[model samples]
Target chain A: MANDVFAKSLLTRRQALALGASAALAGALPRGALAADEKVTLWHGWTGADNTTALNGVIDTFNKGGKGVTVEPTGYDWDTLFSKWVVSSAGGRAPDLVLFHITELPEFATRKVIRPIDDVVASSGLDLSQVPDAGRTGVTFDGKVYAAPLDVHPLGFYYNVDMVQEAGLDPAKPPKTGEEFLEWAKKLTVKDASGKVTRYGFELPNTWATARWIWFSLMYQNGGTFLDDKGLAAVDSEASQKALQYLVDLINVHGVTNPEVGGNKGEDAFASKQVAMKFIGPWEVNLRMAQKMNFMTAQLPVFGAKPAVWANSHCMAVSKQPNEDKLAADGTFMKWFFDNFAAPATTVGIIPQSKAVRENAAFTGTEQYKYFKSFVDDLPNIVYEPLIPQYLSVFSFDKPTPLVTNLQAALSGSKPVPDALKAMKEGLDAQLKKG
Target chain B: MTSVASQPAGRSKARRASAQEGGAVRSGMTLAAYLFLSPYLALFIAFMLLPTLAAVGISFMRWDILGTPEFIGLDNYRQIFADPLFLTAIKNTFYFVFLTAIPMVVLGLALAMLLDQKLKGTAFVRTVVFLPYVVMVSTVGILWGWLFDKGTGLVNYYLTAIGIEPIAWLKDPHWSMPALAITTVWWTVNTNMIIFLAALQDISEELHDAATLDGAGPWQRFVYITLPLLRPAMALVTALTIINGWRVFGQAYVMTQGGPEASTFVIVQYIYLTAFQNFEMGPAAAAGVVLLLITLVFSLAQMKLMKAI
Candidate 1:
């Protein structure tokens, strides 16, 4: 009878162990095989030191909140990320979220690679009014919000204080008008005994993308339009011609900048004190700070009838999700992303699109922020790249964009401005037709 | 009589058995060889042949990568012919080939002849000459770009020191092609030199002795004997140089980016831009097909000429 009882006890013990094993597996499933947390993948092209740090901080904070959503971020260079996005979208393997330039929103939206986020915005009760007018317009297409505006970076004046002081100009007050700018440039320019320019007073980028942006800003400041009523090329208009002439004169006539060292070299010249002033995006603030260079920011001098600067925004967009659950998770993440937009703006040295962020002490306390306050006050005058889907094909530096090619020829003094402008119009029209 | 018939039947059965055993062994060997080759064959079909065939099909469609491809039927080809940039690209490609190929052949032969002489450090000389060929094209391009920079370049500084004004080697449209050609020749001449050196080594030394005895001068001996024997190597090198010249992309892409005004824009750059940047797969495929045909024609013509020479 004792042997029988012992066998029964052994059987009961085995059964209990089996039940415990199953229960333990069920308990571990949430952390392992059957993760209950929603996985959100984000693809971006933010490789700048500060930009990456800011992005990682936002992601880390979100992940640590234990919101049942894990964010996976992938970073690529700008060109590579764009190509990957294209291929992935076509292959139906796109990430849950993507960060793109506001300029690219129209194309992405029209191609259906990204979904409209109107419902998410309304559900989250997010105030869209905080976004700058230009940022809002940039991310909107066909009466719908396609992306959440993150930050606006505009072309502004960056000058070396030492260089300015050496040129006999007050470092505190920079050139505010076209005539004063020209006079200061002439005074600051230095030449060696061989008549070669050793130090340029002002530097303009020779590359197509940057040169085109500067040209566009100048045109807008002069009340010029890139497209007519029918959305056709209007590069031959009088205002555009004047802008082109002004750019040409900077190199060929005024001789303040050298055409040979025009692209990235011009930016380097400013950093290395080879030039007194340069017009570049606001991101240069952090870059110069990292270099430990003494530089200051100011609004671009009024070279035309009005004050205008070229600006673009980086925006957050949701890719086409596979299911309602994923979509809701993406929407939740995007809402949180915009709510905490100030983190990136303060860390990355970009002007905040959100009014609340702009007013936040985190942004207003920085010396760079104080210097860029004038640019912020001039926000209403900023001009954006055209929102047309064909804009990239017309202006991309990677491809042979006719406008850029012709502009290069003109800027390099290879062709007359009128002839280049005519060619640019013709080429732009052809490209538009092809599209 | 029964024994004789049985003997013949037994021989026939032995022959049949031997033939069956040999056939089985041969079949088994072939199966094993195929198994070994299957991996390479699978990769080639998947990566090369399939993509090429797909490209041909895609050339007939108007696909912008984002949307489904719509069959357009030769419109891409028609557009390429009418496009001025395509024409310019073709012209530039031809110019590059013309400028680079002949110099590579002549310089390669000259260098090989010099290096073939019994001299100290021939091994070192060979390694030095072939070094650029192994260096990465992008690295060479960047190094040369700095060397040719307008303001602070070593080349410009030397030129200015010599009382010649600094030339805008990369900025000027006319000079950009020549600059690129120089870089290409410097990078590629080693391959041809190695081939020529091998061919020179293979030529019998007794012929030169005999020619010397026959009152032939060094130049005459080279022209009569060495040149004729080196024809095969020259033919191969000429074809390779021409193909390499036509396939030039990296130097121009990294150094000048087909500027100051698309002056260095070659056919391959046009195709790359069309496909990746513009996302026009059809036009890019059309450009690729055209480039392939052009390269094939040039190679065949050069081969025939080399054979005749």
Candidate 2:
């Protein structure tokens, strides 16, 4: 009897509302209060234990909150995700949301596959004031924001505190200047009876991603630029040569480190404590902590010229959708992502780019948090690789050959500094032309 | 008159029945036959012909991923000649081909000859010998990298035990190519060994017996009869091994990543880096066209020699 009465009332109300547009408008006025069911598929390149913990934390928070939005995350390895994204973009099957390296956004922005988030940012009234200035502009292409900042990962010096103490050096007073660092390295070098290096002072991974960063950081610290104003290869300058020559001398003249460790199993050597120092990114600190190694982080040593670092950022962006249905879901999902997911992910040590969250009192009073916050502070002084479609070419595995060959030649006492730099210049020029 | 009319009627009816039977037999070619062959033809046209033609067409245009392709006929080709990396890649490719192919053929043939004798546990030996070929190329490459690791590798450990300094197998420019060659030999010798073994079994025992009766030595028999009979198989194996060696990528890619100063960087690896990493499809396509021509020339030469042999 009661149900019949309610049904009759509902029918009369609906009929009355349909009879008047004004009544319908009043009924639909509170759209924001009546949250719509939204679902989004987030594609990312973090799959392993790290991603598991981080992703689950964020998802659980979003589910518990009465936000009426659902986020489904799919994870793949970096290379696999990149290739899949390319194929999906061409096939018009892109995911609602994606996480990509900031360096890669320029190419996609050129193709217009990413939905520019400026209007979204504007309409949402997101306050981007406290986010690092460098992180903000790293994702910008042609004065347009293509991606929302996620995190900045910069290379920093990682030292074994135990080894530093054992070498009779002050662990708290870590090397602050270039000369001091050289002295510390000399003290840390341990040799066997046959003059073979038993424990190296420092081990630098010789891949382009790593070795080039080391060279670039040193060059920048010495007030050098990799490219000139016109964006030509300018690595043959005196500052670059000095920076590269220091690396060569560290291996050959100093003989404090083995050249073998540079290319083959350098990370293993660092992990195994065969090397006392390694210049790596903040991510390695997380890895080392997971491995239960007693390590401490410090900024890159000062060279008395400039204080700059090499860094890259992971940016989140909305992919282009083929229809309005997906576009609406994508918008809702992006809003929910920064409002909710960004908080806990930053809690787990991923540098959150939200102005509100990074400055939250929640992140301010923790010991582990202190380690990463310093990195975030220094991120503004860093530089990202220039945005070019062929940007990866100038810094690819093959492109490093001329540089590595020259370094090796110089170390082996086969070539002078001028000749080595000249060879690299010619090789880079040829590659740029052919490219 | 009645007998003649009956005979003509009988013969006409018989001819009509035979014509009906022939028409039924001719109806056997149905749509299913075409359907059965469609899959293979579709694959061939889509994956082989279309991409091949597209690559050739794209060789004349400058295309990056973002922009539209602009036609610049023969510019990519001109750049190829002017490019020093292309020439270096070609040299590296030939070096790889010679270094990998010679040892692979010789070692595979030797293993086959050794196993062909009536020895105990021959089947197990053959299976064990062919195991590496069954392994994935990337796995083999990584395994070789581990085996030749300078500091902690078993090879270096043994060398140190025998009072020798550890060699930087993949990290030194001089030894990097050799390390890659060793890995290639390990990856490929098993396939060549199987081919040689099959060919060895097919050789006539009567000729060997006659040669033995004529007091020919083992070396003499091998040189004269066995090798001559194996010439055709040898040519085919050499052609395949040469092609495989020139296209050596998985080893260099997985092990050193064409590193230690690009000593192990071959043409295919260079082309892959150019096309995918650089995203310069036009020049990469042109480089591929050059590689195709080189392979065609070499394969034709092999075919001619095989015919002469």
Candidate 3:
């Protein structure tokens, strides 16, 4: 009923006229809102317990809000969802809505299976002022918006308070420079009687974006973009190599992080206090909070010339199905989900991107906000992976793909750093040539 | 349990029915064979034969899964051949085959021969050795992943206890493939063992007795007599082991995911990446065809070598 009231008071022109206010924000509703009934299928890769519950709650509320749209949601792991969505799209049986990383928008857009929602958003008089500029820009390709931005997930610097203080470093004053970071991490590293590392200062888990996120931040701080303007690989430059070599040294030369990796992943090591400090993302933040860790979020250090950290956003997109009803439902459901997302997001500690939601006293009054404040504050320094179609697979933790393994190889002291970079450069150039 | 109980019952009933129709032997048998074979034939055409034929055709084309296919005339094959990663995958796969197949065949024969010595707990040992084969590949991979952990794993703990330095089993490119090979051999060596065990039990006591009567020592008699008889079974296990080695996917997929540095990135992993993950069906199909030819040539050569030996 909240959405029905929302639809009446803000989405439709009739209610605005009756309320004697200008119909400035209520020119038209999407066609699905005007439909008798439509069931919209939505797929996303958010299967974590809290995320699942929160998302299901959001979907449930949206369905009962008298929007004439019923969204049936499915959850899968990211890789499975990606391959399945591609095949499903090729077969002309794609779901009405899909949640995708903003970086993936280009590939889907290039396929022409998902349409730009900018014109529809404009015609329907949907409010856009609340969405962040990064959120807005991330979804737009060639001046056309492809998705409604949901949340931006930046890597938050997670540190164990007990360990930091034990090492005589102030937890409040997190390291600000690469030199300071090394000194602090060296101090934090603990050794046993026989010379085995009892506790690591920090661990760089060689999976997913744990390593890539830091590498990206370091690259940006050193004034290096992953890809140059011409869409060719640029990470082989001196700045990028300097950044990568630093990460490699942490495992090899520094003696802070061990040559051998962490117990499961970086998060597990951090959560269990085997590692004192490391970078973690929002997905782990909620889970870590639930586990009641004595940890805090801080800004990632300035490793090179300036401040930077890696981030990406999850966005909801509409499919370009020929059927008007389904397409309209996709739009209607996406808009509704975008608007009403704050409740579910706040419940599970997803940093709400909408300005109106972020500024709301209702949201500001929550406990999760305190933990999320640092990431929100650091949004200005966030750099997303370059919009390349191969970015996901190329840098994915899983197999046969080039970048992540090569990244691991360099860090684990398996391949020479120069050889690893050369491999990545060649793969990137090949992908670009195919394009 | 139901499947196990019902299978023999169904086979015996079919045999009884065939016995009753024995008077109409040749004509009836021809019709009956066709009727019984049709289901398998249909399935073979639809799933295996048709897809294999399509893959062969697709190897010569250019298709991005979502896009229309274009006949590029061996371009995909040329691309695969030129790819350094494909070469890496080939090298890694051969490395895996050497690590896994050799141990699977050798250790299996040794274990079976030992069991044939009528050692105490032979039944228990056989069951224990065969247990892992019954477990799913994914489960075995996950279990071994924990055991092979770099920091706190059992493998490292045991290594350190003996004063050897801890090795990064899953995370180091140098050691990751060996780790995968160990896991694979542990999981499926039982298949080769069971095959050899059946063949070993078929060997009569008379050969050993005759050799003893001729004054041949135990080692000589076993080598000259038992080994000669075991050649057929050895060739079978060797061929199967080599073929299975070429088809190694689930072990690498589950444990290393073909990495630390793609040191364990086997051929099937590459095919999976190109076919599904990257959606380049043409190159993936080409790689698959290449894998088939390699496996066929390698298996035949392996069997012939075993026969000559």
Candidate 4:
């Protein structure tokens, strides 16, 4: 009887231990009841130091509130992010959220990697009507919104206040017209004994992307369009030719700008006071602020018939998900983000799309608000790139297009303007046909 | 426990058991050898062989990485022939090969001959010459880009200082290719130099001494003895340089971006643009196959020629 009792006790102990171990394991697993706290992964291409800091700050604030949703952010350079996003989407391993250029919406939407956010927007009580028309239009395709636009960043004219004073010009009153701008450029130009320009009067970027933007802006200012009524390339029109000639003349005939100044080199030159004035995007505000340079922003001078500038927006997109709970969580997070993005947008040095955010006293009271206000007021003059899936292929440096290449040739004085435009039109037409 | 005299059959049985045991040990060793090789074999089959086979199959299909691949035989190849950019890429690649290969081989041989002699700082000099080969290609391209910059570049700065006009080394179509070729030769000639140095050391010094006693000049000795013996290494250097020249991408991609008008665009750049940028994987794979066949043909021809010589 004693041995039988001992054996039964041992069996009881083993059974209890096994049950305890299994209970511990069930608690440790990532699924089941514990999965109510879903972690959402967000991938972005914001490499600017200020932009990254602001984004992280927002995420921290959100996470500290003990919300059930946790946002995990991953950052990459623009090119790397784009390629990885494509690969991941194709492999069905896309992140929960992705930030992309508004120009890339059509491509991603057509591929069905990102889903329409109409239901999410409706359920979240988000006011899509409050967003800027350009931003709203940029993210919409086939009558459905594919992304949530955060901001609109456009190119503006930046000038050195000290340089303007030294040139006997009013620092507060920048040139308003093309002729006046030319005179200012001539006066600001400085030359040494050997006739080498020590300080350029005005700088125009010669990089492919910047050059293309400037060209498109000039074309738009002249009341020309990239595509005609039938949606074919009309870049070789008379207005475009005139714009191209004017840009080329700025380099060859006027000689106020350096022909060799291309890419970010011109921006660096302007920052170091080697160039007195430059036409660049609003991102320069952060850079100049960091450098503590005496600089100010103005609307781009009327070079053609109107006051138009090239602009693009960064939009938030949600990758397609099958789980209803996860989708609802993403929608909630996005709604919260839109409601509380003004402070982060200010830190990012961009003009926020929210009308209320733009009019907020906190944003307007900042030192750079004078410039930001000007850009916001000039929103009506914004010209965006063509909203097509092939926009990137035609304009990005990864794929060479005759338009970019020929324009570069004309800018470098290697090919005539007429011939370059002819080639560009033919190439664009062929690319469009292929599509 | 039975004695052999008591049970004679036990001795034969023990022998048979020993033989069987030996056979089992051999099989075990064979299994261990395969286990050791399995890791490498798995990686090779997964990464190299399977991808190659997939590429070959994809060459005949229209794949854009978004949808299912549609088999469209010979269309991709036909498109390649009709494309002018592909033709330009081929022409530029051949031009780059002509510019890079001969100079690399000749300069490498000359440098090797000079450094093979017993001299002070020979090791330091050899290291200095070979140092560039170890640096990354992207770094070399960037360095050369700064050196060739038109406004603030060292080359243009020095030229203007001496009353010479500053040349647009990167911006001008006429000068960009030569500029790129110079940078490439500076970066890669060191590899061939090391190869030539090894071959030079392998040549018997007794032959040189014998030729000297016979009143043969240095040039004649090199032509008759060293040159013939160095033929194998020459063939290798030639083949490698040609292949490397054809594969040029980073230099042009970084420095000029295949401009002032695609003057520096090369074959590999074309393939990359077609594949990733244009998302036309079918034509890109076809271009890759063409490059492979060309390299194979050239390598075989070079080997044959070198053997005959």
Interface RMSD of 1: 2.9
Predicted complex 4: CAPRI docking category: acceptable
Put down candidate 4 lDDT per residue, A239-342, tens digits, no spaces.
Answer: 89988998898888988886566352222667656679988777668778888889888887888999999998888889975554577767777877776777
* Residue B90 of model 1, lDDT score: 93
Residue A4 local lDDT, model 2: 38
DockQ of 3: 0.32
Candidate 1 per-residue lDDT over residues A1-435, each given as its tens digit? 224324434556765675467457776544443334577999998987778888999998896565667688889977678778888888889998999789888877877888888987887666789986778889899999998888788888878887788878987888988889888888889999979788888877555467787888888888898888777899989889999899899888899877666452222556656678878777777778778887788888889999888988889898875564586777777878777776677667678788887887767877678666766776777788778877556767655568878888888888899999999999888877765
User: Over the stretch B177-252, how does candidate 2's per-residue lDDT look in tens digits?
Assistant: 8888888787779889989999999999999999999999999999999999999889989899877777778887
Model 3, A188-244: lDDT tens digits are: 999999887878898787654478788888989999988887878887888889889
Cα-based lDDT for every prediction: 0.82, 0.74, 0.81, 0.81
DockQ, all models: 0.38, 0.22, 0.32, 0.29
CA lDDT, candidate 3, residue B27: 75
Docking quality tier of model 3 = acceptable
TM values, all candidates: 0.86, 0.83, 0.86, 0.86
Flag the better candidate by lDDT, 2 or 3. 3
Candidate 2 per-residue lDDT over residues A371-413, each given as its tens digit: 6665666665686766664455666545435656665555545
- Minimal lDDT window, size 10, model 2 chain B: B23-32
How well docked is model 1, in DockQ terms?
0.38
